[model samples]
Target: MLNNYPLLAKVESPSDLRKLPRQQLKPLADELRAYVLDCVSKTGGHLGSNLGTVELTVALHYVFNTPEDRLVWDVGHQTYPHKVLTGRRDRMLSLRQRGGISGFPRRDESEYDTFGTGHSSTSISAAHGMAMAAKLKGESRKAVAIIGDGAMTAGMAFEALNNAGIPHGGLMGDLLVILNDNDMSISPPVGALNKYLARLMSGNFYTAAREGAKSVLKNTPLYEFARRFEEHTKGMVGPGTIFEEFGFNYVGPVDGHDLESLIPLLENLRSRPGPQFLHVVTKKGQGYKLAEADPVKYHAASGKFDPAVGFVKAATPPKPTFTQVFGEWLCDMAEQDAKLVGITPAMREGSGMVEFHQRFPTRYYDVGIAEQHSVTFAAGLACEGLKPVVAIYSTFLQRAYDQMIHDVALQNLPVLFALDRAGLVGADGATHAGNYDIAFTRCIPNMAVLTPADEAECRTALTTGYQHTGPATVRYPRGAGVGAEMTKPLTAWPWGKGEMRRHSARPQTHGRGTPRIAVLAFGPLLYPALKAAEALDASVANMRFVKPLDLELVVELARTHDALVTVEDSCIMGGAGSAVTEALSAQGLTLPVLQLGLPDEYVEHGDPVKLMSLCGLDAAGIEKSIRERFLSAPLLRSVANE
Candidate 1:
């Protein structure tokens, strides 16, 4: 069944795949799925969803003339097969590795990646834009968006569909949207709409009756009348009742894993016109037995492991990640304070709030994939004098920027934002990196931002944020911290002040400056900064607060030190570095300042160490950059002296 396909290995591009015989497509799909499983088993990535979409990706690429025909993938976690087929198979081994291929569709990476996607439910809007652009240029190229059923729950997806349904300047363009329904998000999708859609799609009688009526109606003399009757019948019986109202020609609940079904259906849709929606049913981890049995656990993975026993849990010294620390602290805080509530936008496990949800059922809210709602919900809770702790990823929180500014910050609500995965997140790539929170949060009027370098600091920061009356965010990175001993209950640290790890003694400038070159480090990057400082014989301060500026420390460092360097695992632009710059400007202290952090460009996926090095956030990289900047200072001083 898998023989006689020259296009399988010969294909260097999507165009090459398009040249194959239609009958051989099934074999190609099989081969592609196998290849994906092999690569993921070795490298470890988003396995389940990609396994499910192998046939769908093949079918779309085969039918569509990509590059010209824009295909925007929603969420992009499932784009492994798409990447492999689109002239990136050679680099598949290096998937999610630093300075290698990204896990998501990056516009800068290739022409095939028409739109960069990391967050969910964006494909339709992006594709709509592309379609509109094509129409404006008088270009006949097709624009297709492949989004998951899970992503469909997001308000943005519906908003896009609503806009796409309207005629383009009163004229609708050719845009095909494929809904890949795997019946699950990272966790099983929640909400009434999800349940309603699942029932409508999975109900055997509903599907059979709809298809049977259509089949009989096509043969009848009253076929047009029967089709209209069928549409009315569907409105009464079906749930995409809402989608029809959105002005889309809804097709299928079709078998997505079946290429025979998908290819013909895609071809038929391709021939037709105006905003097409195909609801294709697929299982996450369709081919892989182990993953199919347990989709959520295997949604995404890391490192090499045996397929037989499944992913082996690596044996290590017992130490909690910053996420786990936050989760424990949140639960403990909730136990102590009855008014404390928890909120997460579809990140139960990722944020480590599973136990909290179980223990405090009334207070915990999983607001689906709606980040905007999550923030506003927390704000509403805070309005009632209830402390709402929003446990969200730094990247995901970007979606709720307006809500954070307008609702939480403006109102000065006591909402504690537990920002997990705050720094360079390994494997998940640029989309998942929480690099901009420091800059974004600090800019807000009533917002206070704190970063925890170690596990203990994470717990303290959470307590500090919770105790604060205004909007506060405690940002921490992914993975294990420096394994600091977790001994006590939650305790609030001094607000807006920093802890000095080392004291200088050169002169009594601002404070005594004996050591010189005060290195202000924030978040998980502090470990490397400390190591670098030891090497350079410099003073170090765990500048815990991103906002409030640590005024006293800044003034002292500026007065005493010949040079000062600010280090953080966030974007240098408008980040922790920017915060320090703003603070120094306010003080009118212009001592040689070096801002070291993540660069302006997006950090790619790889091992955390490699990614840090690439962004100059590593110990060696940070020290070298600081050394180079200081080396240039002497020349400037000579010019000043002249």
Candidate 2:
């Protein structure tokens, strides 16, 4: 599929790549860079991060013998180039599509992908484990973890580093950590370490010694003296004594884009012993001119686009996304309540808090990539009587579930969790899907989980969650809602309630007698269930609350209808549908319940609508499933009565 990459075409795997001359590696990197842009542009995916890691990825695969020696990538969105070079060049066109190559590093997909990572900052721990395994086996294999500065912001990175860098570490040696410091994440990275790294660029002695050492002293023990001198001088005089104190040799402040610099340094680090940290600097969106100029816009590159023309706005006014609707509500809510404060785990952009940040700069807190810290941090704010609204994706929020339970829920803190990306997140696939949120959050005590059906309801739910005395969460899907006209003057909707949308119990059917089925729809699946209910002549209720779950209405519906069908855009296991069954059982209520949701297996990446249809969550699929599963019981009853 990548047609014109002559140098890249030769590299079938890391073995063929190792055979190439050192001088040709740069050219190969160039070819790989071009190919990545071409591939991702055609099929929309992570563009800028992959562009940044071109030479670094090439240099790592080139220097190290992969499959035997592990190369772990942290927050594996930057692995497109790595995927291309490592035996998946032909299948590059199928990246992120259903039944094709995964966007992240999947261990099942390739032997070269030593560890799977979609979330951030687990690379060090995984790579270090491999190193320890090699040591235990008495093998000479090496392990390298390529982690970005953004990933380093997570508490786990330091936890791994703290253990890996200690003298008594189980396996401290032969482990190399290549810090890919691009100075940019999805949102520009924040924290003290970012400031520390920004200042770490000032030391000039390491670069000078690296460039001038071997050439200047080609004669004697002085050459060894110079190399030792570089370390001693840097530790004593330079700013990187922190790594030295941690018991690992620190290298670089080197150019990550320059293959000449990266290749030799990597080769040297590979031969050495003990944990080595190499900090290489590179620009995000390095090769592509358009992406380089505006990396954030080209982050995912959105849908298919002509790379030459770049991103273009559609002529017609686009529908506001669920994120945008949340943003509007957030801004309005902040204006109304003085105690309102916004917090995100390095997701200010993705969580629809850009305008909220601008308007309430003093109240906005970007807590780096630390999701655990974000949840606990919100609890701290809530203790002071401030209403802290945590803007987070449902999947990412899983990282801080313990904190959600212990810090907020147990204590009954009034922290509003505005959970964005609450359903199948489409192209990002199962790792990022909000399918588990309903299941995960509903089980926690003192938590109100609200899922909005439309944009207008999304706004009302936020207001309601804000007004609630304890921890409340609003779960919504990823993109635009079914165009509901937003109302002004923020108003709180009734808490723990559901409304009947359609009531057609025992209505006249075309042929045989119809089934008495009550379609209790949860979250955004209300529309689809409505359509399914129409043909079946069943009653439909829009159950807005997953928790405190409209118990009265649910009991009444179960008593009235012969069968109850619960529909949600989440996992069937421990989800809202499960809650319905549990609620029915608790109240001495017995009903034939059909639970329809995401299956036990992980859903693959593709078009959202198509994936939903495939998962049997769409209108047609829901209708077919309801008819087959529940309608049969009523049909049998009618035959017996007849």
Candidate 3:
């Protein structure tokens, strides 16, 4: 691979990259872009975004004194080229694997990775902090934030822009914000800002005239006046006016892929002072024709595939994902109920709402990358006697916590939150993991939290939550469950109730010299727990709802058995396990309770099954834990004697 591109092969680090002559950078970028596509194809990670940022990455490293000068990447999926140049080229094969490199930037990963990020619209604020720190310490350092056009839709990005553009205590910091306007953010960009940027890109006359006037009028008395006039006129005509209003010296609508254009502009900006904003236009998939044509499809690869042919359909039809089930249910429910409306925070495809959007355009709302607004928007819809189902990722719901409590739950609105990716999302790692939703939402008043056991239950849970007058959440993990039968109708489950799936074969010996143990499971982890139960001959109960837990069943299981075990996919501290312990304590029943779930520490990126096993949530792991905690030699000997 190295022999294919001599320039890229020699560049082990950014310092090594800098050693190459100026003319060699174009070839280097070409090599880097090709390498990114190659690596992502093999490893199954982010593809289009990485391919887009090749020249920009090369230019930034070439121009800036990184490690000393901080570069914070917003929506860090585009950092593959950055990673490749920063002494991790060889490790590209290990991307998102167990003990391998992360898909996004991690502060601990490298000195070049100044800020760790997984969510969008955060780069500007972090870079501003770094820039301000440099000012306070009196260090000659610069901070640059590279943000995507899609990320710019979020209010947080603008909030940072508002603050960063001005001075603190009458002192300014050297900060630069580069808008990598690929016009894509997982999904196609939306909102007024996207339109405004489109206009900015098309307003070539304003950009050309402004620059032409500046160059020709320099050293003349009218130059300063012309500059002021340019700013004033650009406000009405288009181009840089909005950014200039924020107090930054706005530059470009430059070619991001062209090394010649990107390098010189970046070099000039590197020497400038105060806040600077550069708008660079680039393609999502620059070199690859397939991805360039259909960026949304090639946003990220699910697994290894042939790059030449692009992604092909599997030979066998795969099991339907929970996301797909939700999408299908949403359409079916919408057809029945006129008030049924679906909302997503710029995740039309991710939450499986592409078909819904296609079928019911008026009822679908894609509110860009604003989680806080999505919840409040749903609440407002529900206020008008409409049933709004906010289809969002479980990790993203954390951003709208206050809105969830104050707007929806407080008002007791009929708003159902269909939270996808409810547990340890493998490749995206700890940042994208949905480990805390069960713990967070269950505590809120008027909020009901449901953990469905499988695909069939997921559909039922969704129906139940949507029908409830109060705010409710139904969280399911990413991808397919155990291929459970999902042929059931969209009927509501018994409210806040659970049913025993398996019972102990032995006679009920009420807590006296009995080795009988009962395992209560939540969500899809029930399947694994059932497998574990088979070995131990333990009773298994699918505790459906996490918030209004089945206390009656808990007490019954506790009284009949000598010990009880709780299993879930979320964090053990405040998860389903905690609910069981609390229920037992309230009922004044004490039995040995073993809680099993994700640990307190962050679980890094890996294969989902491997990660579950490592966390002791898989069948083998669960059985091993139950055996160690409950089925000791003394207990086994006593059971043998009985």
Top candidate (TM-score):
3
Model 1 lDDT per residue over 206-274, tens place: 556766877887877888887666568655433445676787767656667777666766776776557
Candidate 1, position 92, lDDT: 86
Over 1-642, each residue of candidate 2 has an lDDT whose tens digit, in order, gives 546888888889989999998889888888898898888888889999999999998888888889798999998999999998889999988888888898899988999999989999999999988888888788999999999988889999988888888655455547888888887332232334433432342234444555576778868769888757755766543345666566666765666787766676677677777788887778889988988898777888667788789889999979999999998898998898999999999988898889999999999999999999999999999999999999999999999999999999999999999999887888888778888999999999999999889999999999999999999999999999889899998988788999999987484332245557889998889998888788888899999999989999998887666678899999999999999999988887765688999999888888899999999999999999987886564443222212
User: How displaced is residue 278 in candidate 3, in Å?
Assistant: 0.4
Per-residue alpha-carbon lDDT of model 3 for 1-642, expressed as tens digits?
A: 777777789998889888899999998888888888888889999999999999999999999988789999998999999999998999999999999999999999999999999999999999999999999998999999999988988999999999999989987889999999897332232334443443353345545676688899998999999878867764543367888889887766666777766676677777777898888778998899999999999999999988899999999999999999999999999999999999999999999999999999999999999999999999999999999999999999999999999999999999999999999999999999999999999889999999998989999999999888899999999999888887646799888889898888866554354478889999999999999889888999999999788888888888777778899999998888999999988876676788999999999999999999899999999999988876664332224212
lDDT of each: 0.82, 0.85, 0.88
The 10-residue segment with the lowest total lDDT in model 2: 633-642
Candidate 2 is scored at a TM of: 0.91
Q: lDDT for model 2, please.
A: 0.85
Clash count of each predicted structure: 11, 2, 0
Q: How many backbone clashes does candidate 1 have?
A: 11
What ranking emerges by lDDT with the best candidate at the front? 3, 2, 1
Which residues of candidate 2, in runs, are more than 4 Å off?
1-3, 167-173, 184-232, 235-239, 505-513, 633-642
